[model samples]
Target: MKNNLDLTQFDFKKDLPDWQVDLITKTLSRNFVFKDFEAAFAFMTLCAAYAEKIDHHPDWSNSWNQVKVQLRTHSKNDITPLDIELAKAMDAFANQIQKPAEI
Candidate 1:
């Protein structure tokens, strides 16, 4: 049996269903879209600070209203607990930014 620890084909469907694991790339990735560029930038800024604090940066890109992210532990050349932590934090940050404004 494959080691469940290996994220090459790891399943995040239960908690992070929006994230997809690519065997070829051996990374977990997700694309986040926001209503506008400002919102997207805000989301990235939040995530960047957290990633920096944890010292586990992610491979990501931002284009106007969207940000695409891929998480992997470069040192190990595989996904690890750090990636999971970053992914979870990113999800929360994005969710907070994407929330609709109150009336």
Candidate 2:
């Protein structure tokens, strides 16, 4: 286990689902796509506000129409419940703001 794991708010093996644990426990990563840069940035802004509200920050990058995010507690060098919660929040925000592409 990484020394940075947030034992105060999570268990290394139990706070997240098995798949999420496997995917992001130590090296948290998720990708989100949107209709365009506008939508992608919108989602990022919303997520930024949420992160600020929670006093947690995520490592992220955005391109024209996609955003890649990684969440973890740097102090612990591992995923914590805060990471899980923020991931879910970002997912929900994306779902809420996602628009279908025009053909």
Candidate 3:
């Protein structure tokens, strides 16, 4: 199994697509907008399954048509490679499901 990666070892702006890294909170966050609540919930479901598989859950919430995700290693108290991997997975998942009009 891979361990947590130091924040200094990664480049957030270059590696992550739409994610924003918060220096203070040590979190990577992104907001995904969908066509409706159903789509948003569906996305969350997919994310939940993936998170469970990886054992790296995200702090996330869903609104009417939007899902907000925050990723960090609670044990490490900083952003890690797991957070980056999860963010990438989320972006890929969102891209796959999101409608063309929404993009």
Q: What is the C-alpha lDDT of each candidate?
A: 0.86, 0.75, 0.85
How do the predictions measure up, each by TM-score? 0.87, 0.73, 0.87
Q: Residue by residue across 5-27, what tens digits does model 3's lDDT show? A: 66676777888858888889998
1-103: candidate 1 lDDT, tens digit per residue: 3323655355589767899977677789999999999999999999999998989998999999999999988887777888888899999998999899889
lDDT of 2: 0.75
Error of 1 at 19 (Å): 0.5
What are the RMSDs of all candidates, in order? 3.4, 5.8, 3.0
Candidates in descending lDDT order: 1, 3, 2
Which candidate number has the best lDDT? 1
Report the C-alpha lDDT of model 2 over 1-103, residue by residue, as the tens digit: 3334454555535633332444345755777888899999899999999999999998899999999887777886666667777877887888788856569
The true-versus-predicted C-alpha distance at residue 93 of model 1, in Å, is: 0.6
The TM-score between candidate 2 and the true structure equals 0.73
In model 2, the runs with Cα more than 4 Å from the true position are: 1-25, 99-103
Q: Give the clash count for each candidate.
A: 0, 1, 0
